[model samples]
Target: MFLASSAKPIDESLQNLVVEIETQNPDLLVVAARQLRYSLQQTNIELTITEPRPFNVLEEFIIRAGIEFEPAPTPQELASLLGLDPVFVQSTIKNLQKLQTLAPKSPITVTEQGRLFYDKGAVPQPPYAVQIYAIADSLGETVNFQAEPLNEVVINLPSLTSILQLNESNNLISTFNLEQVQKNLQASGLGLHVPETGKIVTAFRSIGSTQTIWRKISLFLIFDSTTEKLTIHLRRGKQMLDSRSKWLDLLLSEGKISLDTLCKLPNESLNFEREAAKKYQNAETAARLEKIHQQALGNSQKKEVIQLRDREINQKFLEIINTAKQQIIIYATWLNHLNINPEFIAALEALAKRGVSIIISYGLEWEPENLLEIKEKLQAIKTPEDLPSVQLLGLEEDVYLQEIIIDREIYQCGFYHWRNSHESHIPLGELVYQVKKSQIIQEAYEILSTRCQNYAQKLWQQAVEKCDIQLARECLCIWGTLGKLETSLNQIQKNNWLELLPIYLNVVIHNLKSHNLADDSPILQSSLLLLSQVEAEAAFIEQLRLAYCQLLSAIAQQNPDTALNLLNNEVWAQFLRLHIAAETDSPTEFISQQTSQPKTKRKAAAPSTRNKKTKA
Candidate 1:
């Protein structure tokens, strides 16, 4: 029953023995060691096993054998027996103690049961514990018997040749299966879902190796449904690259790209398509809603308003153009100097080319001299077979007035013609309806269009036939006469004439003057004569005389200073005396006496201050 004590070196033989035992009875080592130690100790067998190793390799066996010793094995002896360096063994033991794997136990010692009579130590009992100690040493030191859980498996294939050599094995079949799976995903437009806890079992061969290798590679994938995010987790694999979102946005914005090509991509491409589909669906919904809203609202009223305004403007514009039968007269504040816009020049050019008369008057501010430059450029054309030559008049003086008279019947007056510096240099002008078909307007247009040399002939004929100047003078006199009449008339009658008489006079005068007819000029003489012939009071005659004088003054003021100076001396002095008398309550006798005085010699001078301030 004694335990054996021996120091044996670890060798291949012992390793083989442990391997055989582990294979035969894997569960026996621990159970057998415990059973043998308990059985030998029950027989009171004392065993002592000593080692010089610093770590106590036999300490556990010694304790179980019920033996006590003064010193344990030395460090070097423990190191040799365990096939480990002394430092490593000592550190490991210390660590085990700190981990509480080796807890404190009562030390075995010889002691008397009763008070102090030591029977001279009876022959020490045979050390039966040595046999159990030896068995415990063998069991604990058996590395092959240690059980390890199958945590991971690895295989290596040195080359492709080795893989081919192992064709008969399942490795080839597994490789083929993986390839087939990849192909199926590519063909079906399905993406492979790698499991979150799965591993990649790779089988490969070295370049010239005879054997194939198998390795388990870790991999995982996650799909977050809430966020619509897909992530592939590969422990030892490269990430996939795709430009699905970019390509999809491009296709959505441009509405050009083939859908068939997208669907033909491999399984890995599905994530991109998923995102694209969501975006496209949202856009489609929004567009459909917008279309529905637009359909519900009608635009009939808006269309009608636009149509009415357009028609009114167009009709007025056409009337202005059509009135220019023989000649077109235009007075624009500024004209498009570059001749690039719609202007009187553009219209007149068309008309003149067609043998119709055209005349234009525009301010010098518009750079009308530029017209000459343009003319030069046009003239430079080597082949001027059919281009029309246009006449331009730049009014550097008296340029403040802006008006257009077309063929006497049509006239336009407004600020619409001036193109502001900040605005586009386009022609824009308004037309005023005058006679609507009067001879006066027609003559004005003709006069404007006449050649410079022919202007005098036209003027002479107009003075006689139309008497435009005389009519204008008569109208001025009538306007003054009407103002005096309003004071003597009844309130109701005054209002009626106030509204009607001026309108009638304006229409008649405009018709006569526009046609250049001087026939209405006799109205001035006839009206004056009628007053003188009437047996009316001196006051009434004085009123008429004063009106005549004022009309003359207005005429003088509006005309050139030279024209005003051309008046007859006697006639001019008489007119001036009449105007002065109208402003005062002078005796009729005094006015008559003043008028009888001989005309005094006077220097040629501009119109008087009273006349110069008179408005047309």
Candidate 2:
């Protein structure tokens, strides 16, 4: 809320842009700023640093000579023993005496301190003052800390929410370790010797900390809308930060600005009650919708090009999602980017709750951590029943196309990166094909479903055969939480599925117990949950359900006196325990390839005659 003061003049071009934007959009107020105001406490910290100072050759010899002699020798006696000048020996003795390492009297004796010095090769310097400057945002997130103050202008601003966060944030102070402190000092022209690779020999400690003081630093602010919160674009002197700069990345990460926050900010102004109405009233949005409506009325499969940024695509996606009845198919490059938008995620969650089938297929390789992140987000919104089948499958081969087909009706394929694309940077006219043709829609659906689902099923079988527990678990997760492997099975093949179910469960249990993981470990729980949700024959499904319950109970009760005794008596429980124990004990082998692998030689289902169509 801090504005530029009389100390600085605003640029004429920037002023014109602001005025023009404000005139056009009454809900938005553009402002040009060069300074940002934040509060801090100026703390005077007293630090004690221990440095390793190597002893000189003469000092080392003098101390060693004193320790070797039973009766401390006089300077003249020492000079005679060493075959050196008496005057030089006397001067060295005087220096040691001043340091309290040698007796001041005639006979040179190694004092208690001098003996310690001789025992240790290096001298340890006492506590020294080290000035450290650190800065944290209003949210108490630690950014960069340097020796010189990044913000030197001190000013008092209007009262605001100031979090008193020193004691609670003890770890913030710990960020300035001995090595880091030395670097900051050296950067500030303190002339501290900094090693290029190894640890700094100097040690540091703080004493008598001072209170923090507030300061105002110059930073560019470009606010186009009063209704939206600010998107921080950090400034370095006169130049703006590059998009790929590491420092900018650090600030973005520390600030916790999600994709949703960047694309669509929350309405900050209370000026308008009917925000939805105002959104529709915007000419740009109305034009886009009109074009889509016209396309729908025309030839069902005719292709058309549309220009939209990442944020616009999100808006269009929401429209399709909200209106979706049966299914939603999304084929993208990666999931982490799409998952960044909380609003889009929320919509998907709502659709899942409503029994809408959601199939997400990604082409690029997703890291284990990113996969876990996607799983957790989806898991949080999963109901106890896990309705509306949500499946995230990866296509291993190269997939350059980005497309979305909602209910086999609307199809939109584009060059845009979708969720990962930068709104400000992406040029206005990127090509995206929009079509409403029933034939094309069905084709896209088949391509996505047949490819992704088949890949997932294939991966599950391969992982099981290879005894790759990690990959097997991942495939099982896709099968259990999201979608069923929709391959047709005969009576014999169905039985094989049932037999493989226990082995899959056993493999998972073996993995958990191998790691000494707890009974309620996410891995164990998720594996069980996924198995329980698998769609199969009545008998097979029932067996999986009972096994899940028994394993959970048996594992939860470590003691034999409790439900462990009862659980042990259960037939399925005994089977599962023995199966897991056998697999765990062997370590290398699991269910043999003969029993676990199901033959996927089934015919594809015929395409439906009735075509439910929607326009792009």
Candidate 3:
């Protein structure tokens, strides 16, 4: 039989796509062409109408498209994103849907094969820490969060909200759900042990709350100068319970503490119920005050007729605002009356009544006073029980997008936040006039949301200049969480962030240079493979003169073995040549400088927690 199939002529993008057709009969062959474009209806990538289609070729195309391309773009949108034909995009998207490679969900969801391919393609997999860091960063970008404790996801990290709190999805951290150990975790004291400087601070907490009633703990992290070891300290304080709630039962069984801390007394004394009645009396008073307040907030105001396109956008935005269970993040630079409108404020006030924490982040301006005044008013619209939180950035960040996230259920992000009421400022390409910015380029995304949240957290971390025990220890604990990796070298490859290596190396170099040498500054040793790569592409090592000198000096003073390792590496030798005081290219001058200071060994701390090797 002759080879015949219904894909139209292949484009440049589909040309690179690896398609595999599993034919039922070995002898039969098929020829594929690119499909239709702008038909208003749909077509297939491989239209084999004669017999039972294997669907393998279709699945392969979808998997490749999904993993490699982004924003879950449709074949049409993907074509636009990649500068391909709309017909080719449409055909590819249809075939993928037929084969079930792409989920029917909006913005498209890739099948498991797509996920696995993306995971396995990393040249070297960054360990869990980097993955966590990267995830947190993505969430922050997706949801434009402002400053507040636990408000941002911190990049590449498991969703902090997903991990810390439960939602309708019940997608909490499966390994160690906080609910299982909530009492202990929420009441515990947070500590970060930094061996570099012996300084320590007793308390670390959110603003307004004076005492450090930690919601999370940072285990001690030690970076060994002699061995390049990263240890995650695990030892925890009291108030933590054993899983299964047995810790409390076990504690009561053991008869350890008094009735003061445990859930209940084993025996009910005559004094108890009478004491509870008085508590009820006080609650009754509070209920009466709540009733009075509720009367003040009469019937919901009449809905405004917004002139925006797509009525669905308005409905969805209000739905998210009205039904947020936990957290709401509004990152809008343009907060004027024309932009924000009255309906938006009413939604915000309604959610405030439900104890949904709302954070309003205005874009950073040259002068922040006007934004601060706006924030003051937003904060004023609060219920007696729950107050809306507003953050006026002292930041100089110039992000031009507005993002709104209601828990993880809904998210909206776009460049429309930059537009003012003036028609001149409207985006030139977007012809759809009535659509809300959130709906115009609909990318209903979760990963991007997580990334946005994570990015915000890192920004917060970077913003904190002082190294109190809490901040220092928390930052250091990442090394401890880094655990078995020993150095960023083994871990860097796993992340598949080779393209971003120059940026990362610059950061590591900055850290090394800034750290005080007397403070037992730790150097992250890298494999010769990575170092050579860095040396060839970016020349990162050559730029780190003081850092290289400090590292060589430390190795020379303490670990002769480490000094041998560096000297043996060909990539490091060329970098070392830049530091030769005189001629003749010898690292002995830097080594000599290192030897001048007597090396004092600071003892490394042991890993503190159980499951010492597992990812936190």
- By TM-score rank, best first, the candidates go 2, 3, 1
lDDT of 3 by residue, 1-616 (tens): 2222222222223333212221332211212212111101011111011112233444454456665555555655656656767776667666555544456665657755334333343111111110010001111111111122232222331222232232322211222222322222223322121212221111221212111111232112212111122222211232322221232234334665333222122235313332333444345334533433343244134211122233344455566578776555555445541144457667767765554545454445543346566556665774321222332222233444455656544555433422434432223221111212242213322322333333344442443444232332222222221121233333346433243333333333322232211223334445223544443334443334434444455456555445545555464454533331223334454345456653532221222344333321
Candidate 1 TM-score versus the reference = 0.19
lDDT of 2 by residue, 177-216 (tens): 6666555555545344333321133455444553444544
Candidate 1 stretches with Cα past 4 Å from truth are: 1-319, 322-325, 337-346, 365-388, 420-616
Steric collisions counted per model: 44, 16, 61
* Alpha-carbon shift of residue 580 in model 3 (angstroms): 64
Whole-model lDDT values for every prediction: 0.32, 0.48, 0.36
State residue 246's C-alpha deviation in candidate 2, in Å.
46
Q: Please report how far candidate 1 places residue 426 from its true position, in Å.
A: 6.8
Give the least accurate 10-residue stretch of model 2, judged by summed lDDT.
Answer: 586-595
What is candidate 2's local distance difference test score?
0.48
lDDT of 1 by residue, 1-616 (tens): 0011111111222334433433453211200100001000011112222111122434333222222234444445555755777787555444433323232332322222100111221112111212111011111111110111122334431221121132222222122243343333234332221212111111211122122223322212222221233332222122322222333334434645322222222344344434443454345334533432343244344321111121243345545665454445565545542233345335544544433334444555645546655545433321111212233444432223344565455654333343435544433433222233344344434433332223223232344356454432223222221222222122213222222222223322332222322332444332223222223224444434434433333333333232233333444444444342332323343233333431322211222456442221
Task: Between candidates 1 and 3, name the one with more favorable lDDT.
Answer: 3
Q: What TM value does model 3 have?
A: 0.23
